[model samples]
Target: MISLEEFKRSFKVALWFMFLTFPLLVIKVNPIERTVLWKWENMAFVGIGAFILSVLIRAFFIQKERSRNSSKNKRRFGYIGDEPLVQFILREPKYLYPLSGGVLIFALLFPALFDTYQTNIMTTALMYVVLGLGLNIVVGLAGLLDLGYVAFYLVGAYSYALLNYHFDIGFWMALPIGAMLAALFGIVLGFPVLRLRGDYLAIVTLGFGEIIRLVMENWNAFSHGPSGISNIPRPGFFGMDLSLDSAILYIYYLVVALVIITIFVVNRLQDSRLGRAWIALREDEIACQAMGIDKTKTKLTAFALGATWAGLVGVIFAAKTTFINPASFTFLESAIILSIVVLGGMGSILGVIFGALVLILLPEYLRVFSEYRMLAFGGILVVMMVFRPQGLIANVRRTYQFKKSTKGGDS
Candidate 1:
């Protein structure tokens, strides 16, 4: 039997979801027909069903989790190995080459393992992974909040789009050039907002992103306005005449390679002197400055590096879609990337990768819950903030901090 408090909690959740469902149900625009339709009854069913399911799942899962955690805690001493070597191999990062190799093999063959629809989804997921990593450098490592990171992505896409259209630059040849342009733009944006932090910094970056998108949308001569540039060249190797399947497989492999490279680079950077400096800066700007780290130089390099990653993704995105448009690079894109970083565990290598895959793929898989996506997202953010503000998977450093803080608590 449920208690009064439990009933109250569930009732409030139901009310919130009911409120959320009203908007999605009452308004629907059919893109093909260019018509609006209202379906209040349909939405009402969806909302009421969701509320019931959520309450049931929450009540059931909460008790189950408590029991599972309790049992595991009690059984831990009996299961865990006493041997130091066994423990070291299990815990240490350096001993995980075999695991990494298996994952790499699986990723390289991912396209062949699934149908076109699924493979396309995987590709999209990896692209966001790349974007998340790029933003990780700024927000995760440097402790900066950037809301206009999509500007760099836009720059990269348009750079490749224009170069390929006019100069006949191949995808391979134009990729680096596009990334460089984005890095340059990053520096341009970085200079003006060097002193700002938190909300002020976010607003400036958001505005900068909007400005880039608006320019692309209105600049009819260069970007061709809303029509977008088409027939963008795809990446290929050594003049190979490839079929559609082969071409897609090739692209998948290439992205996997890039993801591997990104993982390696980010991991190395996270362990390097520069990464430590970024963390210090993130912890406290004044404190880092007092330690003799040049504020301007360090911050600019962080921005440029982060933007370069986004720029690379932009080039790949243009190639993947075979077109470019201002609509593709919006503030929402920036928000999603940032969300990936935050959800994954900022400053945690494994966290970012897992975060990207979960956030991207979960939505794709939850198509049945399409109308409730935003509602679910809002709930997730709120829950994470209240329960595990550190993230889904906290970095070891952050985990240690949590433990240390709790150790001194009166309770």
Candidate 2:
């Protein structure tokens, strides 16, 4: 049996050989002109080749390590016991604030650098971030698999649309009402499904989302059905109409403000007692129940809170588009939002944001290849899952620090 060290050395050698051979394989082929090759196909080929190579190398290393370990008795050992190296670094609380503050500052000040299209994409991404964060509260922390999150979003949009259309209410007043309505629906939905678990719960929530869509479609009396609501109101600034002048800039600032508020609320929730309980429930509901936590209340709160955020984003979506219909709140939308949460690393706030950004913006960035955009997007998702299953930003373990007293304390 090959020792782990020797196997690892051989694997490294093989990897270097593959790397050197890849260019040679493509060089003589001359499949297409260099200029045209640079446009798309060649780029994709190179990317795919590199990805495959990396995967093989990683697999080789893992297998080599395993093989070496399996025959440990046959190899001479250096010592009876080996201690792993441990490094402890003191991290100041201030470190977090700088990262968050810098991102906000850059986003706020650099509005002009981003084109109108990019700004629109960013708005959509931010909306998803809100949705993902809200869903994170439910599915990530509370362990609820909600498939009707987009229903709350629909409720929010329609709330604003119907209220403004009938009562002449502005976006500002309708925003809160929309959120409340969605939260109410969330609680209502949670009541029946609370008894169900796993697949049953997922199916029920999915049915609820479809029911909302069907209601919007068939109930022409209220939703306008297939035609849907049009000419919705845009968000304004203290009676200053965004439509009158630089609407994009005004909307951008509004979105930034909303994003900040969402982040603040989520961060606070994650640090609160409720947050810990939710996490405990996620790990094991029976254990949580044993600890005297009321499962019903915790689950309901998660549902309501998650729906509330989705509703808020709905209001923004309506205001931003100035129109909406049943089509906007489809199953695909829910899937995308759920994907954001999962791909971002369920419980991680920043991970969800990064996931939303990448998923939403990547297609827009690749618009030049409109025909192949979705295929490329799918490939990217596959690559990401295979490579970074933990997500773009892995969850950081929380380390509690204690200051030792000089009088008498163990360091």
* Candidate 2 structure lDDT: 0.79
Q: Per-residue lDDT of 263-332 in model 2, one digit per residue for the tens?
A: 8898889878899888888888898999999999999999999999988888888888888889999988
Q: Spell out the clash pairs found in candidate 2.
A: none
Could you tell me which residue pairs clash in candidate 1?
none
What is each predicted model's overall lDDT from 0 to 1? Answer: 0.84, 0.79
For candidate 1, the per-residue lDDT at 197 reads: 95
Report clashes for each candidate as comma-separated counts. 0, 0
Each prediction's TM-score against the native? 0.79, 0.77
Per-residue CA lDDT of model 1 for 27-102, tens digit only, reads 8889999998887777677767876887786777776675456643353333344333433443556877777778
Where does candidate 1 have its weakest 10-residue lDDT segment? 77-86
lDDT of 1 at 296: 95
